[model samples]
Target: MKIEILGTGCAKCKKTKEAIEKVLKQTGVEAEVIKVEDIEKIMSYGVMITPAVVIDGDVKLAGKVPDEKDIRKWIAK
Candidate 1:
């Protein structure tokens, strides 16, 4: 599974990335996690908000940080 966190390196963005990393570590899930900081790249995903989470090329969460449970559920899918 591929997980991408899109943001401009803000606090929320960093938090979002950390959340995913925490979940991955706790669950021992092997997935590629990427941080998308480029404006053009983030916009290409049609996400106008920072701190977005994309899983396997699909936008799962946007504009806010998600809880670990929610992230685990998405990662499990």
Candidate 2:
């Protein structure tokens, strides 16, 4: 699975990345995690908000930081 975190490197973005990382570590899910910081690249995903989470090229969460439990559920899918 591929997980991409889209943001402009703000506090919320960082938090989202950290939360995803924590969940991946705790769950031992082997997936590629990427941080997309470029505005053009992020917009290509049709995400107007920072701190978006994309799982396997699909937008799963957007505009906010998701908790570990939620992240785990997404990853499991």
What's the TM-score of every candidate structure?
A: 0.96, 0.95
Candidate 2 lDDT over 5-72, as tens digits, reads 99999999999989998888998999899999999999999998889999999999899999888898
For model 1, which pairs clash?
Answer: none
- Tens-digit lDDT track of model 1 for 4-67: 9999999999999999999999999999999999999999999988899999999998999989
Cα error of candidate 2 at position 36, Å:
0.3
True-vs-predicted CA distance for residue 55, candidate 1, Å: 0.5
Which runs of model 1 end up more than 4 angstroms from their true locations? none
Question: What C-alpha root-mean-square deviation, in Å, does candidate 1 show against the real structure?
Answer: 0.7
Clashes of 1: 0
User: Where does candidate 1 have its weakest 10-residue lDDT segment?
Assistant: 68-77
Over the full model, what C-alpha lDDT does candidate 1 score relative to the true structure? 0.94
